[model samples]
Target: MAKSEQTKAKIIDVFLGLTNKKKWDKISVKELCATMGITRGTFYQYYNDIYDLMEQIEDTLITDLNHRYQLLPLKSPNGLFPPELFDSKYDYSPPQELFVWFDFCKNHQKAVSSLLDTKNGDAYFVKKLKVILAQHINHIMDYDGMPRDGLREHFTKIFIELHFMAARTWLDSKEEDFLSIREIINLLNTMRVGAGFLSNKQMTSPDFEAKMKFPADREVL
Candidate 1:
């Protein structure tokens, strides 16, 4: 990449690093620029605002996940919800990506919490999930008798929104409630199957509520 492009990428890395250490409000563009020895003008040249950088990070993460999924031989019954999907063998374990993300949140707990303080964050995740799930469903659904138009869209939205809400709640919890990436994958599978994206037999165990709980030692009063 050219020097300017390289600088812009470095700026994004610095911003995400800081985001892990502090809240968004606590992050100062001036400081970020100073740390990287760049001027505010250079920062503005790349992004309209801090939130723009955030959106970029979110988009990049999603893109990376999609790319990772494409490389794996996910052809079996358990392929969709397999815990091994995040293993290091593929150079991109889902759980490791999640850990990196959650650790970023934990590092910048105060700032990250504020982002989730409103419905906007939740809504954004829901919308993104809806799009992803819709595509995934269409790729795997039994369409012979299935309604191929409006009903699929409706089901996709509702199921994705519900899963998005649950995921946000799990990630934003004060305690380290979500310990396993498999649990998250399983929950997502249940949501997809329940929404008719997959066959009923494809659904995992039904005791999802109990399974979604925090560790016994980490329970809050």
Candidate 2:
């Protein structure tokens, strides 16, 4: 990596570390730079302000999750139809990448959750997540029978709602609610099913075992 990019990453790291330790509002650039052994000028070269760093962190987290999902060896639900839906290899199992994601969100619960409250309907994060889910569903299901635009709109809203709710819980859980990757993946799978974003064949995947898994428990969601 370039020295500039590396330095910027280190700065982000320092910011995230501090964020985990205290509220974002309480942490200052001076403290972050001091913790990272960087000068204030060096920090400025990478970020305009603390808000910029926060934005960067949020963007990076979502981007990383999407990228990781693309790399997963998911089996399309083309052949899995009703009565046994969600039986595809894409069983809601989160991969290694997702665990890292959970850790990040859990550590920065307050700051991250605050953003969700501020930017629910209009946030780029929510929009990007919609697009991500739409594309994935398109590949795994046959949406040609329905109005694509309508499906996208409905599915997006459901996805965002579930994600935000689960994210909030994951961040604020008092018990060992930190879910495994499979559990999170299952939660997502359930949401997609509940939103009616499945192919005819996918609607019968043996994985679902009769829509019995909808509205997963608190731990999974």
Each candidate: how many clashes?
Answer: 5, 18
What shift in Å separates residue 189 of candidate 2 from its native position after superposition? 3.2
- lDDT per residue for candidate 1 within 23-62, as digits (tens), equals 6546788988988888999999988777777677567656
TM-score of each: 0.46, 0.50
List runs of model 2 lying over 4 Å from the truth: 1-10, 13-38, 51-59, 74-122, 143-152, 174-184, 194-221
Q: Pick the candidate with the highest lDDT.
A: 2
lDDT tens readout by residue for model 2, 1-221: 99998998777666655655566656788998889998999988878888788777777767766666667675533442343333443333333333444555665565466555432312665566556655655553442232344556666566556666777666556657576545775777665554444543444466654564465565476
List where candidate 1 sits over 4 angstroms from the true fold. Answer: 1-55, 72-129, 143-150, 174-176, 191-221
Candidate 1: Cα lDDT at 179:
39
